[model samples]
Target chain A: MSTVLLEEEMTDTPAAPARLLSAGPAAPGQEAAWEQFTKIPLPTRTDERWRFANVKDLDLSPYLQPQPVDETTREELLARSRGLEKAAGRMVFANDQLLSREVLSESLTRLGVVWLPLEQALVEYPDLLQQYFMREEAILGGQKFAALHASQVRTGMLLFVPRGIEIDLPVEAFHWLHGANSSCFPHTLIIAEERAKVTVVDYYESADTNAPGLACAVNDLWLGAGAQVTYVCAQNWSREALAFQINATVVGRDAQARSLFAQLGGRHVRSESVSHLRGPGGRSDMLALTVADNAQEVDARTFQIHEAPNTSSDLLYKNSLDDAARTIFSGLIRVDPGAQMTDAYQKVRNLLLSDDAEANSAPGLEIEADNVRCTHGATSGQIEQEELFYLMSRGISKRAAQKLIVNGFLQEVIERLDQPEIGARLAEMVQAKFAAHR
Target chain B: MSSLKIQDLHVRIGEKEIIRGLTLEIPKGEVHAIMGPNGSGKSTLSKAIGGHPDYTITSGDVLLDGVSILGMEPDERARQGLFLAFQYPMEIPGVSNANFLRAALNSRQSEGEEIEAVDFYEHLYEEMDKLEMRREFTSRAVNEGFSGGEKKRNEILQMAMLKPKYAILDETDSGLDIDALKIVSAGVNAQRGPNIGCLVITHYQRLLDYIVPDVVHVMVDGRIVRNGPKELALELEEKGYDFIKDALAEPVSA
Candidate 1:
């Protein structure tokens, strides 16, 4: 748990051109941020926020900045980048580089909806980009990785829905890690003005099987008064890669935000999600589903901060672990002073599929306000013997029965999404993951 | 030509013996009923034949077309043309009834063979119509939050869909009212043909009137003491089970 300097980690990473520091055209003071990124110390076992994490796996010395993918590989990824049948727009990224962009319906552009890649958004809407980009500090033990993402991120998407504008179809972004021993940082920013409604989906994948890669991702979401937003993150990296994801959500007066994170891949994954209720009558729903197997580890840390009165937040996280896999869920709800009538609930459920698999759950609540309702709980269980027997009696094999029950267990989270297209897509991805691993 | 035969079966649950020295035969094209008093091992006999893990066959052979099914797993036995209509059907959450039935049907087909979606739906609707099940049941989770009568009807719906060579209906008439019993019985009767055999296990003679069993067997103390033509069911209803008890207590003179 000794302190390790970032300079030591960077000694193995070769220097890149100055243009690489700035993610896009008008991201102001990128050089200063890169300088600050190098001074932040790497997370160690001694950090309380990373208690159950496999700290040794966080070593970044062996990884280097990813090179641009070849044209053939780019074409292949673009061909395979399929999602919902109907999307408002789609952007695909490989190794922190934009591969392809598809815009839907010229009518949407005429409606004043700004859907562009980060580089383009930086150049065209510099003021908006500078206002909301990474404004929230990292507070969930990913400070070092957050800084790394800010320093190296070059490709992502920016979605802005103007006031009173509602889009029927979801916008999607796909990020793929392409080669062995390569690393990429993908960032996404979404802003919904007053009374605007939208849904955004982000998918993470690896281009090849068994490729060792590093994926550091950051997402910033802002919801104005009465705005409703749904964000879904489908993270399905290869089994040999390391992944770090940091998500921060800000909900304004009377605004409602719902975010669902589906984690299905990566050898070692650490996800930190923070939801801030910044105004009265704001509600945020945080949900996550993780399927970890084959010695993989998934560590999730979440925070729900109720900073205003009459705010409510509900968080549900479910994990299914098999083989020698491990999962850690640590979540806390804090109701600050003057945040009266605040309601918060945090629950973590784990399903262990093997005797050797391990699941650690820690749920806590901090209430400094009166007339507040806060509850938190964690539960770990295996497939019910009777449920398995019932399925097997219906002629399903043991393996298939376990798969069905696991899917059924995780289906609740997807059903909570209440978005059919995205739910169906997430279900397909989860089923595909199960099929491949089994 | 197909028959389900139980030969000198002795079954146990954990360390306690349940079905002792029992034997029966049910052949295709015939509906046989087994009526027994409470604690007579009628349900145990059905579970033992269906390969329930809780019941162990210390000495017995359950043969489907003359092959012993004791060595097979429950699903293997099910896929090998054996079905057990449970008295209390399981409620599987989040698994649609259509999907559950499809999985069962798919298990019978060879690998890489896909079930036609349209044909499957058509067939399912037809069976549901016979049972008077609402079309919404297909999309609902299997037996989840279903009423008592609805759960029993779902069991019958499954029996109709699977079309196993041999089916053991263990108390399928337990929780149904008179109306539901008639509907369920009609559903069972419709599936009766030269290709399928049925063994109806019940505690009361009430179910026998609806299904019209060709043979009635009175089981006592884990064994069938008397079996006769369909008229025996009517006689048992009139004379009560005391007739068999008195007869068994008296020695059989050579």
Candidate 2:
């Protein structure tokens, strides 16, 4: 591992040149786009959304393309990635290299379904990949990181479901970052055509807690007319790592989409998620849960856009902060002029476990449609004293009681996913993170 | 040697004295009843003895097995063999009863030692059966949406599992109908043994009828005015609390 770290350290010096050459495989039309990405500036302290955030901590200088590990380490990570024993298919990647892939049933694959790695998908389905790749720009101030991700990403999964087909079980993807200052770009693109239904889970984790790495990831979901899609992402990067993820979902007429983001790790992390209810009767649900402890900081921003009549969207984000950790949630819901009957709701709840911990929430709604129903709220509070007393009276220690209450508070958002297996696994992971902090 | 001793305990809440120099000793192998009207500080004494932070113990001490526990935290006090069955149990949303009870038991274990899951479940199921609780109740959130009777029974179920040396039942009979009272009392009676002491607090003497006490103490104005055998509860029930209050007034006036 030290040898690999040494090699990664040496490669970090020429990162910019390596990134430029990495973009050589892009199609002709993407050449100008890649150049445009190079011209974009990185986020700085002057940026409003980046204020209060430690911009100096956003150092990408020491990270390099992670080197592959031995078969023994790969096997160990593969065994650890075994979550949700009943998953439809499981794919494990170590150091941005695919270690194993469990193929789905033939019947499901025959229904015009495509479940393959991003590299393989790029070679086999170039046209399909081109249509959705980086189509929706990072409007939430992560453009530089998003561009850097597009230029360097090599390990990810693509799920393409043809018209009118529904996959009952969810597909799973795991991306593990190993070695010091290792960088990984995990990309997931899911396209469900007319009347199709599908679910996908993208899990991010690190090989060890001491490794300082970077994860710049993107997930794009395109739901066609009358389609339904559910996407869940659990980000459990190492505590010494930095992570940035941008997610965008486009919903067509009568289509429904639900997405959940679980952030249980990362020393400094920022996530931006946007949902575009583009056509009539489209609906989207955006849910997030974050557990920030120690000196970690988690910044999350979200947007819901009702572009057509009868569109609806609901967003809920919950955070539990301990020690000197901090969390910021900024969300907005917008209803267009012609989007009559638009229904949107946004809520952010923060549970503070320490006097020094901080939680900042900003919730906003703009409704141009006269008949729209929109509500947004943000609340920050410590665990109720009476509730703590109730648990303590039952013989639970103060520390254990606080953990239980926080878990219960966050379970509301997890339960909203309506997938029992995934909810349980996510809860376990969150509990594990809490235990580590203790 | 199992016993709970309260020595002239004076507790206050916001500068107002609730338990004024009240003392009581309950030894193992016996059941004691403290009957009083509302605002008589019966609940305050129980909470103070259990080491609740909100209830300030201005004077005196609480002891378990002759060991002082007044300086310990509530959970530490509990681990020292003291338990307080709350009058109004709180509703904890999204935390299953099984998990809550497991945490409580886990807290009692030595550091870095874990409870055996199979044995824990077996003990839990046995206690639930004695309390007449359904198996499905284990999965429900702790006391969330539980009826008054269910909450009291759940408290008894916890007492059974914890097997405390001394347990204080504060208003355990309040809001319970004849059927629920019988069920709850039966659960309590089943736990009564030579190893455990019980202090049952109630306004009415009806609860004593089922889990008949060995001694009956009449508490009024934050002090125990009279102490006697089991028949005393029957006498008090026949003649209401006013008889005791009027009787005590005459002596004070003289």
Candidate 3:
């Protein structure tokens, strides 16, 4: 591959920001979103929504819009954007620019399943895209970032599965940040109609793991009556990047939604996930795994609201922190008065590998409903000396032993996904990170 | 020189010394049973040999083959062909038995060399069958939710897979019934050959009946007072430990 200057590409067009902004309101309500973003204040130390956060590090001033990639670089990134071995479909994007797309198989397309880039979906199915497009603002302290995402978001995924259609194979999307101090907004919006089921895996990555950049992402999953959806986001931006991922999931009558965030990269990552259990027998499983090391800080906030009777939600978030890394987990379970017979469980576990590493967990519950069952807890601990020595005693080196123990520690959460192939892929990716650390 | 040798080994936990001036050697092709009363540091001896971090060997040296292994880490000592079967085996929650054993075997090889999965599973299943362990034990986490007999058998299963040069069984028959004791002893007996040295630590002669050691050492107050043939275990069982005290009171005799 030849190294070519992106400046030459820019001369043919304008800079990336001007080109993207001049396209004017990429999505509906985006113009108003940019206005709202200017009004929302940056996080402050006194702000309870920003508790235990390094408020100063939330600055977005250092970030600049990335320049368009040269053809050679785009091809290189597209070639490197590997995901699952047998994905039903895939879309790869770099610097908010679509690089490639593997359209769905004929059977899926014939079944009226619509899988397209968000921009293309707006043109082909304008009425369908408007219904679930950034339907609500971020409610858990990411309002400004969500608005910024809406304004700057150029391309992502729009997957719509018709009623009673269950796609056995998962669809994947890869969003890569390719330049230093540049920014990208990636979005994934899924709508599963009544009795329809689908699984989607999204990869948020960086071309250079050491480059400083900004990533603002939003993913919303809407499951209609009896629908089921499983969504996973593997966030592995550069080590010096500041990133935010806002997730909103709504489960209707008897529907189920499970979304997981595998947080492996970034300097400071703040993620907010909220689940709305909207109707009777609806259930939501919110899971997250964070493998944080060095000076990385991961701040995760979650809210599970049971808005209808017989609704349930389960949240499990596990973090393994090493070196001087830090993690914060704050979660709440709310049961409305009309949502009696609700069941909600929230658990957060942090495995601290270094003495300097820190973990903070606060779990809360609000119950205005009768006959509700809700339990929430957070625990932080280091690897058991006995367990480590036990593995080491069998001839595994200290690093290998810790890796094995940590892998086993995380097996519990991975098994809950019940997707063996996807779970194994996630485990392998995590092991690659561990190997890279060594 | 082809033996695991301990020379004047003194072990301590915190400020309190446990094993004082303990000297012993188990040459290849032989099994040495050390029968001691409580607080005699029999368990400490195995732990010190295994290079446990807590049991500090303050003054003496332990040798594997002819090389001093006192300076090595626990894993290095293990890679140097030393295996210790804990009296109370640890239960690792998420590590499958197959993976743990495979790691041990792989650790003994060159870096990045893993054993073939098919051959590993076949060999593991063969050995598990010999120990009467269920086939499902391979997928289950190492020793998690295992019974007393199953835990001991699991330890022996590890010994079978690792095939260490020196083997230490710290009360291998502690909580076993007669049937379990016989099965565990048979498992150990299968590994006894000219290429391996064994040390069996126990309090009762009942375990000795099944294992049938070639030599017996009586330890009291952190010191091995006498070394005798296999018949010594029966004698100790008949006369009880009090007789050893009386015998020690007598004047020195060859």
Error of 3 at B48 (Å): 1.4
Show model 1 residue runs off by greater than 4 Å.
A1-28, B234-254
Provide DockQ values for all models, in the order shown.
0.61, 0.64, 0.74
Model 1: per-residue lDDT, tens digit, A1-438?
111332243234434522333333224556565666667777789999998999999877667676667667778999888889999889888887777778886677788998887877877999998899999998998987888788777768899999999999999999999877788888999999999999999999899868988899999899999999999999988899999999999999999999999999899999999999999999999999999999999999999999999999999999999999999999989999989999999988999999999999988888899899998999999888767777777788888888888887887888889998898899899899889986
- B1-254 per-residue lDDT for model 3 (tens digits): 99989888899999999988888889999999999888888998998888888988889789899899999999999899999988999888777888889988899889778899999999999999999999999988888999999999999999999989999999999999999999999999999999999999999999988888988988877678778999999999999888896677522211
Residues A217-328, model 3: lDDT tens digits: 9999999999999999989999999999999999999999998899999999999999999989999999999999999999999999999999999999999999999899
Worst 10 residues of 3 chain A by lDDT: A1-10
Candidate ranking under TM-score, highest first, comes to 3, 1, 2
Itemize residue pairs with steric clashes in candidate 2: none
In angstroms and one decimal each, the interface RMSD of every candidate reads 1.3, 1.1, 0.9
lDDT against the true structure, per candidate, is 0.87, 0.86, 0.88
Model 1: per-residue lDDT, tens digit, B1-254? 36888988999999999888888889888889998788989989987887778888999788898888899998998888888888888887777889888888887789978689999999999999999999999988888999989999999899888888888899988889999999999999999999988999988889988898988888888888888888988888889888888888521210
When 1 and 3 are scored with TM-score, the better candidate is 3
Q: How accurate is candidate 3 locally (lDDT)?
A: 0.88
Q: Score residue B144 of candidate 2 by CA lDDT.
A: 90
What's candidate 3's DockQ score?
0.74
Question: Could you tell which candidate, 1 or 3, scores higher by lDDT?
Answer: 3
